[model samples]
Target: MESFLVLAVLTSAARAQEVEWRHDYTFARREALDKNRPLIIDFTTENCFWCNKLETTTFRDSAVLSLLNDKFIPLKVSAQLNPQLTEALRIQSFPTLVLAAPDGKILSTLEGYLEAPKLAGHLQRTLTAVTNPDWMVRDVEEANKAITAGDQARAMGLLKSVLEDNQERPIQVQARHLLKDLEKQAADRLAQARQLEDKGQNAQALQALTKLLKTFPGTQAATEGGQLLTTLALKPEVKQEQRTRRAQELLTQARADYQNQQFLCCMDHCEVLAANYGDLPEGAEAAKLVEEIKSNPEWMRKACESLSERLALLYLCLAENLLKKGQPHEAALYLERVIQAFPSTPQAEVAQVRLSQIQGQPTQQTDFKKAAEKEEGPAVP
Candidate 1:
């Protein structure tokens, strides 16, 4: 009687328990990469009968469930809904399954209906084959994945390693074949870098040469690129451009600092800009800002007030941290620093009170009368 009857669907909860399917390929891929799991991408269509049957029968099988749960990230990509992705993978037939690595390297593919046991066997065999290989095949697969991810350098490294391994494996031949393509790519990049250098675009050329060296380290193109990098980097035009760019950056920072009431730091940046890059337009602008800061009475008062307040706050913060660590004397040193440095700011008053508490006595402010009488005592030179 059992032989005469076809197997029917089992428990209602069987589908949920046996298979975990992800609809979005990107999310599934991220999860797979995070977990270091391979992927089983099930390509399907709404009208596909075999695809539905697999959900009911093949997915319900205990062996299939165990293999999927333990070893793979299962994703169901609908050909109808995801036409672009389907076209990318070229999934023409309904119910096509692709087993891929975590990095999106397709390891194997199967089409049409597969009985549960046969499907499980196929997965098991794939696992075994990937595990027991001479590593040349796996390295090639990884190289392919790197290339897909826009990491040509990594791909080249893997291919180079395989070739240098000196193994008699058949996959070594494939690696050699792939490396020639990589060599050509390296040469093309080297050519591009040279062209940029010839056009006097030193910065762009420098970047290209650097990338070339990194991408094709052992290639002849990389060797030439390295030599070219040295010659281009030493060009006075390149050096001048770099210096001018740095001067502009410093000038911008100085302006921001001045605007933010960080006057002392602004002075430091201003001095560097005026001294080193004084010939450049940015340097000249920086020099003008410096003169304005020193000559403007209102600006001087604001700079002095803000500098004192900021320094006092910093000292207070340090003192508080030391106090938390149960170092009262250490805390007192920073508190004293606030009194000596800024003696008039609000944080300085706070520091004085804290210092008095630590010393168990009243404290007097330090006298800077003699120092102030001298010519320019550490006040924004």
Candidate 2:
């Protein structure tokens, strides 16, 4: 009788390890919140072989099943059934796993297939993050205080510090949102200063820029404001003529570079001119040139076929150009090509970083050229 009882207990325990995924996301989210666990939403479509493979193989693993049962409130969301949720989350591929906090803020999104061990590892890491949400909450609180006090720099610093750390997905998302808000605030202030400068209110514009730099140091707006300040200091008529002449010179150079087949160099000149003088005729011409170069199939084919570091650099430039044009999907394809073709090169690492950023993954701010240089080590002959 005792031996029979032991066998029954073992069977029950084994059965208990099996994962039970909730079909309803609402219920799963409520349960996750009540249990203080992360919610794992597995997004799959009808025609995805990899999604089926993941369900059959990875999700069926004893360890993965156990982790899902014990640590997460798992929900299986069919793209067909949950079209709104899929669109809201921007689910682009099959077998995407989104780990979100109880309050419905996404913590991380893992795309594609993973073996049992890797999936288990990811679950464990997410569990750690879910269990330790206090640090992130504290950081957000402090950042809010800094912002309320009109200390933009301190707020930005605090938010960036949280982003730099390995925090939960919601924390990183919140940080990114706040950073974008801060950037917009800085931009608005810069715009106000520019308006003042354009109206020949140089002294007021200078004052505004000085205040803006103090509030939003280390931002793109501050850099632009600083450069604008120099131009503002000059007589308005002279500044206008100088700007026109400079824009023309840049456009001429960019055209020359493009004709000479220096695509990357041409892009640089055109981008600068377009950004700084987009209101001018020269600026419009520069922007047109950039578009022409970017859309050139022959130029792109040559860049892709080039040897060594140049190929990676060309790919990177193309990706950046596409991103600036608000075409992230197209940019990602080029980035993937760079990674696949030059896996061992420094450019590959930078490409990966940029790809992650485009995918809404947590990534640190990185300079592409600087990252490549660091990875390449000492210059080669």
Candidate 3:
């Protein structure tokens, strides 16, 4: 019986890991609410040490789970992983707890850690208010329900009604601001679609561009939208196809630079990729690479390099980081840098050996000019 209890406990924990907790609010819009249940959100992040500890410690406590599961649809979101959702909810702190209505109006938000019993008490209190009709969540909830039902007009009408009902309430101004902010965001996205197409990301850029031009033609993006249509008309469909492939290659090379610890070069490549092809696969890839290496010391140093170190030393540091990381493919790149930038340095011999290992060749060191012409870029020793 003791052994059986151990297995059962482990099995339950594993099952809990399979729960879909982190999700977008927009995704909730399409979900059929229980109407009987309230929403409980636990926003977290992979990088937050406290959040990880909470999951392993407090959240894993059986009593905590029992109360949460019974009272609310316990949801978890990684704030870092889901940035848009984080921004939508104005989340500034990790381990944010939001008690929400089924229609998405927040009942309350708690920021930071809460011990088991306190957390359970908070949920119970919020549940009591949610179950009562006189609570402000009702009208706010109704307005969001309209938004979910694709009745934007009705949603705005409901919001207007709520504003009148809550005229003396402090949240009335905040509600008005939310409406304006939403409108501003809608306008911004339309503008962004046009800006994207203007730069040549036809496939990734066109759908939103076309939609905005149709839906909000009097907006600034629509006036600028003609330039994109003109560009599209001038290009052969074949050129449109070629852009994606080229963007992919650039993005791949940028990621290689990052993995190799050539931080500044990697970031530079990504910036060029994103700016030129923000709607393309390469642009997306570039953006991801940028975010991944944004915090690296090598990246920061390279970006701040003042040329105090000889060029060879820079390449050597880059190569060492890459090699330490076990990314031989990227390490080879920095080794080449060392050779071209500092041929006379004592490190050149080690770089040569690394290159040989990279290519599985007997070492016959080549000169920088020959290396560049053969490799199609500057040969870093």
- Greater-lDDT candidate between 2 and 3: 2
lDDT of 2 by residue, 203-303 (tens): 67878998999999888999999898777657776567667878989999999988898777777888898789999998899888878877998876554
Q: State the lDDT of candidate 3 residue by residue for 137-233, as single tens digits.
A: 4666776776577554455555566566443232454456655544564568666866766676666566665665564444455556656655664
Q: Model 2 residue 360 lDDT? A: 88
Question: TM-score for all predictions?
Answer: 0.43, 0.46, 0.31
User: Candidate 1 residues 1-381, lDDT tens each?
Assistant: 664343334444555476888899889999987886778999999978899998889988888988898888899998889999999988888899998876677878899889998999988865654342667678899998998898888888898888774533346656777788888999999999989988988988988999999878889999999999999879899988778778888988999988886777788899898889878898888878888789988878888887777777878998999999999999999988887777455676688788888998875444343345464565554
Off by over 4 Å in 3: 1-32, 133-381
- Model 1 alpha-carbon drift over 4 Å, by segment: 1-142, 168-171, 177-179, 214-218, 252-266, 293-381
Residue 81 in candidate 1, Cα distance off native in Å: 58
User: Residue 244 in model 2: shift from native, Å?
Assistant: 30
Best by TM-score: 2
- Ranking 1 against 3 by lDDT, winner: 1
lDDT of 3 at 365: 55
